[model samples]
Target: MGKLASECETERARTLTKEGISMDSEKVIKRDNEYVLHTYNRNPIALEKGHGLYAEGPEGQKYLDFTSGIGVNSLGYCDLTWAEAVSEQAHKLQHTSNLYYTAPCGKLAKKLCKRTGMNKVFFGNSGAEANEGAIKAARKYSFDHYGKGRDVVITLVNSFHGRTIATLTATGQEVFHNYFGPFNEGFVYTTAGDIEGLRELVDRHTCAIMLELIQGEGGVMALDPEYVQAVRALCDEKDLVLIVDEVQTGVGRTGTFLCCEHYNLKPDIVTLAKGLGGGLPIGAVLLNEKTAEGMGPGSHGSTFGGNPVVCAGANVVVDRMDQSFLANVSERAVQLRAGLAKLPMVKNLSGIGLMVGIEFFGGIQAADVLAACREKGLLVLTAKSRLRLLPPLTLTAHDVEKALGILNEVLTEMEQKAPKEQA
Candidate 1:
């Protein structure tokens, strides 16, 4: 009798999975198309819930999440400690304008400053805003001290900055420069890892040289250490501000709290986002003392910046990302890279820590690999020509192995489907 009851319960669960909650995915997609703006090219499925390294769609199908919401959910979905802190803050005080002081924001700022050795911080709501703040600070610093004509900021080709008018202009990709007419001027792009190109570009009009330690969107390319050192020397020589955009690589993503630490270089301004708030939206610009003082009162502000609820969540994230946690991130990277390299279709693998990018041969599209992985109950991301994977730092070895097994199967199938080469 007990066995029969258990079988009945299992059948009920399967029926619920088939029926979904309200309706089928096709109906949901149609409804979304009618109501939601056509901004993102969304997938066919809709996610409903997520745990440590797995997410379930509305259809109740489970998937190992390697994308981690594009690297924002650092501690994974619904982390107990993070959720508790956020809930506590949400219950006590959700938000307050920056005009008044708040405990969580102050505590988070102090923690960030102390950990990073930066003098001060400016809070915002997204990575672009943080970069915008940094750009504004850099421009104001140059204008106040060096006077006019020092406005141009040199960035790297194929670099991914924010989507704001200023940050979009700062972004080096020509693809994003469309539709938006009359972008902000005084931003130039030089080839990555080219010291001579940067030197030639730096002139009387140059104010700063901004870069990402790892080009996340441009296929996870890490800058050469010698090239980075050259840029640092040039910035110091010309008294130009050095800005590092850590929106994707910051907060222990690259085995260090800051990716710049791997290069042994410090920047005048560092912009952070993505993982800082765990799952909440928060962005910050950490500045050195001299550059920080450039912004006086009434210069800049955001209404929802530094909300207590988000900061409370961020505190839990920071606490969990201590030295021991970061070491684990490094170890996982080695494991993932080694596993990926053994795959037949994987031509090359790049990136540091858990921020990995896998390149394939025989003209295998990243989209196809992503689709296959999804079909096999694994979720991943695509970066141009490479398949990107930004798994949660807290993912266990067992989860990693399971996800990699699915990836290997997908890549093998993709390779098998490719056409044979001409003799």
Candidate 2:
């Protein structure tokens, strides 16, 4: 009976693979279109397997990955240490209700607090959830101490917060605000790095000012250091909570454990996700002493917030992001930017550390550059008018050279195809 059952499972797996009904990108897209809501404009390629900075598509074509699953795979795909830790923890204990304390979760929280100097940590399932927790904590802190009528949160224009109702409202982009009407109130928007604009908008009713240190989706724009410092001072004087949304820029993406370290500013609240779980889903909100006590028991909860398996993976990820590892990230960023700048199609480069954006000149659209790069066996991302690159932190010098070579070839082809100027 056991042999028969094992044979049955093997046959099922074989059948799925043979029929391409498994995780094939095309098949998955077809199934998703038939049964799932279409929200993303997905690329044509279907990813199947990965190792370090390389991924294989369903067709078995190898591509050098510069997306890193949109900045979620910090250590690259299928990292041995991370996989082993997750597998071991999964066998021992996958999950338990938040009512019961899990050692892995506690250990992860302690590591985060100790490394970041934050007073407390609240776990969740994604970047959006972490930001949501931060928002709730900020509002509750204001309500408990300063009384009612001060619940407004000031987010910068072009900032991408999340898709949840409250976070959607908190998001500053006008495009996301649509189709979700009668939205949550008390969320306001301000221009990025505009000190006067921020001062004008932040009133007694404003309880918190949330921002991304480097707006990832907003064209990879970095906030001015002086402006950040000014906002920190204002938050302190006005008793307002300063929340840093480090969803994409955190976890050594910007050559630091937290992007705030680059500015040397300590925010009232810091939210993390993306690379925290090493490709597994996890998010956290770190709070200082003043706001840490604001969230009491029964105030907030999540069922799978800090699952043991996810925390175990996160522990491994955190352990790998040492000082030497982060310095290499900076060094790679320099190499990537210098290579991109040499391309004739490249107009300007933006962003810091590994999160980079290449702007094309001669009226070439970002979409064009992305499509060209994709066709050349190089996976890349785009933000507005710039070609974005978020390669794995573990990407070697050889992989970088190969990607750059492909990019150069594509850009040259594009230039050759262009029409000459009219005399």
Best by lDDT: 1
TM-score of 2: 0.94
lDDT tens readout by residue for model 1, 75-149? 998887888788778879998899899999999999999999999999999999999999889989999999988
For candidate 1, the clash count comes to 0
Off by over 4 Å in 2: 1-26, 419-423
Whole-model Cα lDDT of every candidate shown, in order: 0.90, 0.89
Error of 1 at 260 (Å): 0.6
Q: Whole-model lDDT for model 2 versus the true structure?
A: 0.89
| Superposed model 1: Cα runs more than 4 Å off | 1-24, 420-423
Estimate, for each residue in 1-423, the C-alpha lDDT of model 2 and write its tens digit.
334445866898799889877566778668767887778888877777788988998668888889999999999988888887887888789988898989999999999999999999999999999999999999999999989999999999999989999888988898888888999999999998799999999888999999898988889999999999999999988999999999999999998899999999899999999899989999999999999897999988889999999999999999998999998988888888888889867778888899998877766778988898888889999987788999989887788889899998988887777765410
**TM-score of each model, in listed order:** 0.94, 0.94
